[model samples]
Target: MERRGTRAAVRTATGTVRRPERTATDEDWPAACREAVLGGAGLLAALTALDGAAGSLDPLRGGLWAALAVTLFALLLPPRVTAGQGWLSARGPLRRRTVRTDRLVSVRWSEGIAQRLVLRDDTGRRLVLDPRVLLANPALWHLFATGARTAQASGALLCGATALRQLTERAEERTARTLLAGSGRA
Candidate 1:
């Protein structure tokens, strides 16, 4: 379906039209990362505060210390998760990638420490994008996965396998260039 800039157009082989409801944006990446870092920091701060407040000489001091620790951690930690157009971008301690809906070939759900989204190109090379930093929102993650599947099924709006492969190759080349540049070799 063809719409204005607000929606993605999907065309069938017979020239039928469909409009996709969701699109991805770039902001989702850093937000997810910040959330993860803050959460970890909060936990550490809480534990530290508890230890500091606990008195070696007083028995009641242990409970008091624990309460103080929890309070401080809650005050210091902030939630970070944002939704974007066409894609769910997330950044955490070890994750950094923009998952383009058009480039996604498959989505898999698992009961693990993190949720995994597998993207593939024409050559069958795959990139595993995991947004594990935000373990608080399983629903949102599921929504993103479902959206990816929907986008993949819509033939008109999906990227061709060959095009995806070229994109992957280009990305690798760019990474190499970046590394070389940093090393004073580019």
Candidate 2:
């Protein structure tokens, strides 16, 4: 009987563990994309300059020009993601989109070469993002988690909680693995 009671307490404690809300600032940038853009820009700039100094439009010049064009576009068009109390917004060179996390009714994982988070809110406003953006930032994750929890608690979240929960689990697992590896215990 005592062992059963202990197990129940442990279950209750772990079952109700809630992820805190998160917030994002304007300066937050996706680390992976930034690295690619910066590295590409530097390498392309060097190649383009070298091609120009060689005094001929050679094959390398054409390739460098094309690569430089792509790099510049990526550098200038990086997406800016910001998360607030109940919302997450993404702004790029072309457009800005916002998602009301509190109003989310469905969350879908579009997995492929790159994984995407597809969220549809109650008001039909949709936002697609790379989950790494949220998982990479704790404050942003907290805001999203709190909003989702509110929706789930209020019965406003009709579906997709499973997806959210799975993401949260993945984040936790990754954190655990990272810690263990760092400590040489993995």
* C-alpha local distance difference test of each model: 0.48, 0.73
User: What lDDT tens digits, residue by residue, belong to model 1 across residues 1-186?
Assistant: 111356668798999997655433333445644565566566556655666666342446655655655555444433333334445554433444445554465544343665553555333545454444222343444445455555656652244445334433544565678679999998
Q: Which numbered prediction scores highest in TM-score against the true structure? A: 2
Residue 66, model 1: lDDT of 51
lDDT of 2 by residue, 22-57 (tens): 356434465546776677776777766777788776
TM-score of 1: 0.31
Lowest summed lDDT window (length 10), candidate 1: 133-142
User: What is candidate 2's CA lDDT for residue 80?
Assistant: 76
